[model samples]
Target: MIMNPIPTQSSEIRVTPIPRMTQGGRWRVEAMRSYTSDLLLWFTRGQGRITVSGRTRGFGAHNAVFIPAGTMHGFEITSQVFGTAAFFPRSLNLAFPQEPLHLRIRDAAPQGDLTLILENLQRELDGDRPKKERAAENYAGLFSVWLDRAKLQYPQNERKSEKADQLVARYSTMIEEQFRSGRTVSEYAQALGITPTHLSRICNKSCGRSASALLADRILYEARRLLRETKLPVQQVAAQLGFTSAAYFSRAFQNHTGKTPSDFRRGA
Candidate 1:
């Protein structure tokens, strides 16, 4: 599950065409992995199933899938597929769906508009036109608008409480800023003016996972990324992740990922 960093044509965004298949038709066997950037995949002609953060769903033509940064995901294409993939940093500040999304573009106008945006985005990346970066950003903004419309159209059941949602979002943002500091869940809860138990309950209700689990997931993802993408040793990676000892870090990583840090690095 070692994913190489995606190359970008622009510093802010990347648009790449997805091939129908690899030369040997063996792209399906790649292990599940994740990215440090947000991903939006548009399938114009395809049949496939995608797994995101342990949930699997089927998709077909005219579907757009979103995988937020650091979420583990993979795909299997059953038939010939053609698509465009957009990768952008989370700092772009687009209010995309918080969770993974599989949006179907059924209506003709929206689908055609989406296709045109993708085409122009590709052209902006490929051609040496003036102010191409700004052009790409504008197209990316339009694409985000399209996705927001799709999310609005998608039906929902009972929604989580607004208060709970706000708490979870704030907590998540704090984690991103402070995960490297070895802060405890209780400390984070105290900073947010809530008890640790209440924070856990809110996280569970909002995302079906505990607050501690979310914190540990972020730490482990960073560990894996460091192990795979850098030459840092296991001990160094452990220390960088705020572990007290290399041995403790190894045990924690094994418990969460079923692989020792050294083994995982070697495999990668």
Candidate 2:
């Protein structure tokens, strides 16, 4: 008599882009690590348990959940699995809900609206990427409408913080995110309706640094990351850090750390 061995299923995942709603990528369960960058996940089909932000839930078909940026989490992948994930910038929450905490729908599934959003998202795969604002507006518009159907209470939200603090934190996260995109302090300040000085003051009081400092830090952090992690050469690294010339970036790096980028990378 011959006996059959049961095969153990590998619970991994991949992310497919659905147009402007997401920039494309794939993720496996093991790839879910403590990422400083934010991520969004949707399970189109499968059954498993996921622990996000420390809460575990059984998930499967017609069930969806979201994990905010900076959440330390992992999940169990079992049986036949399929899904899509979007790598959302932290700035996106400023335009809508706060992610894992906010618990906005990932896909409606059995719910009619969410299913439509997923369908529309799937259709996104075939076309050219739309302007981010248009795509964002579409997602925000449809999702907010669904949120309107939510019976959550505002009393808890009001008790969390005043609108000012909320806006400041959200915008700070946004600035840290998009500083490389060429927008300036004046632009961000004007958009936030405060003088640049006041915005700086708010940032200093809340985060112990000026808004400008935060932006520079993001740039420098990326510089250090590229310097140590990738094979891009010195001049290219300088350009990637938003410097026009390697000489200028060297000076800036020295000013910050008293060391040249080459020395830093060697030691790092």
Candidate 3:
């Protein structure tokens, strides 16, 4: 279920249960997408795999995943997972990590501290109080502090970096920067000084997906978002995303999402 939304004219912060966010469709939650606001997901129960910046890792209880704005990421959640997704607008200018972090909290004290902060944040938003926006901001600031302290308390273990991991990481970064350019996988592989087959091979090994599939997922997620959230015409949307023709955009979108742009927008 959704908690009360707290939003200012210029920014927004909302707390919602993890399972509720995926009530639409699996693709809505599993498809690779980025946001203009930073996202922190706190899982208190269950286990699943999440992919951040081309690296997939298993996550379980008390695992906190922080994704910076504009990072391509996605996660698979099971029915038993219990979590809160706190969205902090990057415009707030709070102290947030520049990179994605996966922190598995092993201690109960810190875990309780995070849960308390989130509870307060949700309460403030749900209550009918004066200056609620300011109170939400204050809680958001406290949440960031909690995150910093938790990071120090539960430092991530370093893993040996394989060549494939490094390569896929670089490719993921490039996709984040240029996904809207409508560049093909071959073109991207060429820019990285590798053949398309080599790039796809490494990507599959790194994330269990092909390079082309990864690129298309990122592109289609943006397309879906724009269609649902904006009033742009179909042709304009296609052009903005660098598609040569509206028909081509329509075909690609349908192939990926099983819905035409207009139909998706109408239903949305």
Candidate 4:
């Protein structure tokens, strides 16, 4: 079931339950959408698979997935799944994971604590108490702390290659800032003081996608978001995304999404 939207004066934090199923009891074909908010998902029951940045992984009960803002992700729950998802606005300023994390809470104590933290966060979101926003932020901070500890106790295998991870993280950050400038992968490589081939290799090892593909993915994600969430004309959207002309943007969009801009906007 879809959880009710949180009513709040500020959009810094939101807590909601994952629906047992999406529309028609099936996952949307375009489920790989990126969000502007960081997402923390705690699965209390059931099993499923999630894809982040083109790398797919399986998840089960007591697993917590942390997806940083602007990362492309999608999930398919094969059975009855129960979970709470907390979305933190980009401006929230918490020291959570900057990279994607798929953590399994194997111990009982941490699992219970996580459940309680989610409960408190939900209560703060659902209540009208004094300083509700502050209380909610506090809960979010606690959640971040818990995540840090959990990572220390259960380090991800990706951390084994620290240098490669750092390079990928830096590349991702640069893409976020310069994706609107129409920079090419070679240009990004130059900025990062690395060759285009080296950059692609690191990105492939980290996320199973090439550097050019990642750049294109970020650009396409922004284009789709603008098309779906705004009333901007196609030409204007193209210009805002640094395309030289509307026709060029249309071609690129069609190549990436298999739909023309007009059709995508209308369907959305």
Using lDDT, give the best candidate's number: 3
In order, what is each prediction's RMSD in angstroms?
6.1, 13.3, 3.2, 4.7
TM-score per candidate, in order? Answer: 0.66, 0.44, 0.89, 0.75
Off by over 4 Å in 2: 1-67, 70-159
Q: Which candidate number would show the highest TM-score if scored against the true structure?
A: 3
User: What tens-digit string does per-residue lDDT give for candidate 4 at 118-184?
Assistant: 9999998899999998999889999999999999988786536477767776777777677889888
lDDT by residue for model 2 (187-232), tens: 7888888888987777665445576765665566556656655678
Which lDDT tens digits does candidate 3 get at residues 138-222?
9999989988988898888878888878889889989988987889899989898999999999988878999999998888876
lDDT of 4: 0.78
Q: What is the C-alpha local distance difference test score of each model? A: 0.74, 0.53, 0.85, 0.78
CA lDDT of 232 in candidate 2?
Answer: 81
Error of 3 at 167 (Å): 2.6
Per-residue error for 153 in candidate 2, Å, reads 16
Write down the worst ten-residue block by lDDT for model 1. 21-30
* Per-residue lDDT of model 1, residues 120-204, tens digit only: 9889978899999889888888988988887887643344438877787678767767777889999999999999999999878
